[model samples]
Target chain A: MRRPQFSALRERLLRAGVAPRAVRRTIAELEDHFDDVRRELEAGGLDPKDARSQAYARMGSEEAIVASTLARPELMSWARRWPAVAFALLPAPAFAASFVGSIAVIACLGHLAHSWLGVGLGRSPGLQLFSRCFALWILWALPTAAAAVCTYAAWRRRISLLWPAVGIVLVGVLGSLTNFGVQWGTATSRTAISAGIGISTGHLLPPLVRAASTVGLALLIYAGCWLASRRAEEAGSEG
Target chain B: MGDAKALLMSGVPELLILRLLAEREMYGYELARAVRAVTREAISLGEGVLYPALHSLELSGLLRARRRQVGGRTRVYYNVTAKGRRRLEYLTSHWRRIATAVEAALAGPQHA
Candidate 1:
């Protein structure tokens, strides 16, 4: 229909927060359906130009499609429906979950290694190995992951970054409060793993200090990404 | 009057789509053809109404869509889910009741 302006339709649907997959499928199907309809019309003895015009008419107006899609609540994303939850409220929780989940994985791996490889994780070399991984996760991976998730959620939803920025800071501060320690156990205990929450309780600096630094690092990374994207967009427009 | 017609027409595309897919899995073009055939072109839904309704149904867990290669073309086929079947049954009964009531009304006091 009028060449469908399928790209424009795609942009409109995405701008209106229809899921990308649905939008892509819809546009593709519409293009294909138009071709079929035009072919059928031509077969029915209409002129090629008439068939083209009629095919467009049979596809319905673009506004109608957009409106109908908008009316379906389920087609809109969760982030679109609740920007606050997806961008703001979920970051700290997501950080907490990442920290806990990573710790669990490390612990599980230790257990599996001990069981399968006859290595006592409580001993020197084995304990040292898992503990290094644990420290890396707590200090670097978990915090970075949380910040990345928050940034990505905002970017993907095409929502404002104000809440996600707040979310990143909150996650950083809250994530720093947890103290995780792994050490060789006493005679009765195996490899001892401990978790507690307090201000600067672990090997890290004070709570406020670590939070500020972590947030600073995360923001730096995010800023670099934003700058790169902006430059790319500018370059694209220029070309 | 336009609003009323639109309101009445709501759920109609979903019902027809679900009912058709409930019988056989079909891609978008094939399904549209089937709808035209079954309704004798009386209820021809253009891409606007049809695709949106299909997507809504899929998102609501009422329909399942799959992609398959057919004669070198990748066609997406849709089938009604268990949830869609229940939804179809409900819509069918509801439509029949409305049709009966409208018929009775159209037939006037004697029929009532």
Candidate 2:
């Protein structure tokens, strides 16, 4: 399969530290210009290959274009200039906090259900199951809430979801790894985590399997949040 | 264009761009064609100069860009802002002043 011409240009611009959103917009605009020129040339009876070459010639040397764009400091996105700091500052802390907050809420509810309600009132299997499901559902809610916040941040910056998406995945990986570290640290108890699938803490999940599952779950949450934020922003911009 | 003429044309691209965009919203390619046509082929803007100028203009809030789907192609069209129009008027007056001075100098002094 033929790779799109613009893909290589996009990669080069990105490698040169151009902002991701600017790279995308610049590539799209240039591609549109080149295609329009080629179309016009072809209509004048030039062959497709010749027309494309002429179109490129009209656009000027590739190096000059790229260099000029890079020279324009205004076009460089904040994230592009300081990627490490950008990833560290944004969405990561917020995501981690949201995840931790969700876990705390789940724990508090679980305690209330088991001690306050179940023992004091009546031991009900349905209430126990409800508590477990609620905990899992709430755990999933953490990523979604983080996604919404990231999306809003992106909109405010007049940027696309590139950083937000990266932030979500990065924080997700960090969270899962932290969980794995804790599990590894305290491997004595046979804790039964009644996630959608009940896994006994005694026979701890294989490290590989657990990591894969964690990453998978994180991805699922990221995908959901990404879609929600995109849709919401689209609706908001339209309104 | 001579070195002197080229040096003098440094800021003309932005002026011409704002002038063309003042007529109607146009994408880069269309604006480029308009520039050449309206200047009677006296001016030709390379894509490099045009795109960067457009971006900087938009950044400075002198122009607004909107992406539209036209005939299945994504085209970013630019329109001059009120500020852009005022800038264009100022540049136009400035250019006319220089032109009048240069024409008088070229025509030689006449006895008053």
Candidate 3:
């Protein structure tokens, strides 16, 4: 396959952790510089091929350009670096906390409602399982909704898709891990796995189901949100 | 240039850029050519140094950039800020100090 022109230069700058905006600007400037040189050369009567080669020679080696550019860290300003990293990281904790907190609060409210109706959860295990599963779905759906809104806003602004996508995935991973931890803790304690009052592993399955379903639902929501936002952006741009 | 001269050149570009932009807004190509002309070819900052230096100066709030079409071509023009003027003042004085010291050293009695 034909290689992308300037791929090496792009990779070098990006690998050195240059801001994407700066790299893009640099690329645009390089193109202009080349054009200017080529124009000058062409005016002197050289053909396009010779003019192009001579233009490229005037810019010096790619290595030298990348080195000098990156040598001054301000060219990749911390203003750009920290904000992008922070924005990508912000949603992870928010999503995880929302998922876990939503589940916990919903579970508590469900328990209270059952107790008030004179039918405690443990007395009706099937109802308890259903309520918990519903709670898990809500836990997954709420953050997914919030993420969708964020994705849509970012899409409208033409911000990069990579960071938000990364944030959503990270949020999902973190939420899943927290959900697993809660499930394991609740199962171990409620099952009386210690104090010589062990219960069957089969009985500890509800929380496991809750954990898996919540993560699965979250991933689905994220994927759906990303797709919808991307479609909307494309349609808006085309229109 | 020797290592000593290279070291001095390191900080000189930013000064020259800020000084020139303080006078009037100019684009990358114009600035490069102007720098060469004004320095009588004693200093030649290639695109490599010119652009990154511009970006750095802009990031530092010493310069601001805008895009405008000139002769049917879009060009990014840079202008010095109030802060840039202050920076130029400081750098100019600093350069004068060093140049004066270097000049005195060169004119000192021959050790031989």
Winning model by DockQ: 1
- lDDT for A132 in candidate 1 is 78
lDDT of each: 0.76, 0.66, 0.65
Over the stretch B40-59, how does candidate 2's per-residue lDDT look in tens digits?
A: 87765566457877897898
Q: What ordering of candidates by lDDT runs from best to worst?
A: 1, 2, 3
Q: Write the per-residue lDDT of candidate 3 for residues A50-87, one digit (tens) a residue.
A: 99888777666787688678877876645236545643
Please, what are the lDDT tens digits per residue for candidate 1 over residues A13-58? 7768877667767888888787788899999999999998898788
**Sorted on TM-score, highest at the top, how do the candidates line up?**
1, 2, 3
Q: What TM-score should be assigned to candidate 3?
A: 0.59
Point out where model 3 deviates above 4 Å: A1-5, A77-91, A94-170, A173-239, B1-5, B108-112
- Which has the higher lDDT value, candidate number 1 or candidate number 2? 1
DockQ of 2: 0.48
| Comparison by TM-score, 1 against 2, better one | 1
Q: After superposition, how far is residue B35 of candidate 3 from its true place, in Å?
A: 1.4
**DockQ for all models:** 0.63, 0.48, 0.47
Q: Distance from true position, residue A133, model 3, in Å? A: 20
**Predicted candidate 3 versus true structure: per-residue lDDT over B48-112, tens digit per residue:** 55787888889899999999998898899999999999999999999999999899899986665
Which stretches of model 1 miss by more than 4 angstroms? A1-7, A17-57, A114-134, A177-189, A194-239, B39-44, B59-61, B82-90, B100-112
